[model samples]
Target: MPKLLMIAGLVLLLVGMAWQFIGRLPGDFVFKKGNVTFYFPIVTSIIVSVVLSVIFYFIGRFR
Candidate 1:
């Protein structure tokens, strides 16, 4: 179950990356509101990966 969750998380991250890459925003093709800009989709991906991993880790540990 743990392995399955890890795989699913990885898949989700990959899908998000692809979607970000393929999709475009308005005007300057930006995806930011203020202060920061988003040119790389990998950062969000890493965050997702970390969150998923943590959640899955705890789930596995508890079970």
Candidate 2:
């Protein structure tokens, strides 16, 4: 449906904006060695999870 598409688009836009802010959070790990690299976003994942949980909790509470 058109409404669903619009909501999805909005969510994508918000996520893209938020990605720039969240991508470099502390406790996120990165390791590099000659010809090899590794990256993890542990802190970023936790922050996002907490944020989304709060948002949904409020939405559900109100509904």
Model 1 per-residue lDDT at 33: 68
Flag regions of model 1 displaced more than 4 Å: 1-40
Clashing pairs in 2: none
RMSD of model 1 against the true structure: 8.2
Candidate 1: residue pairs that collide? none
Candidate 2: lDDT over CA atoms? 0.77
Cα lDDT for residue 44, model 1?
55
What's the TM for model 2? 0.71
lDDT of each: 0.66, 0.77
Highest lDDT against the true fold, candidate: 2
Clashes of each: 0, 0
Single out the weakest 10-residue window by summed lDDT for candidate 2. Answer: 3-12
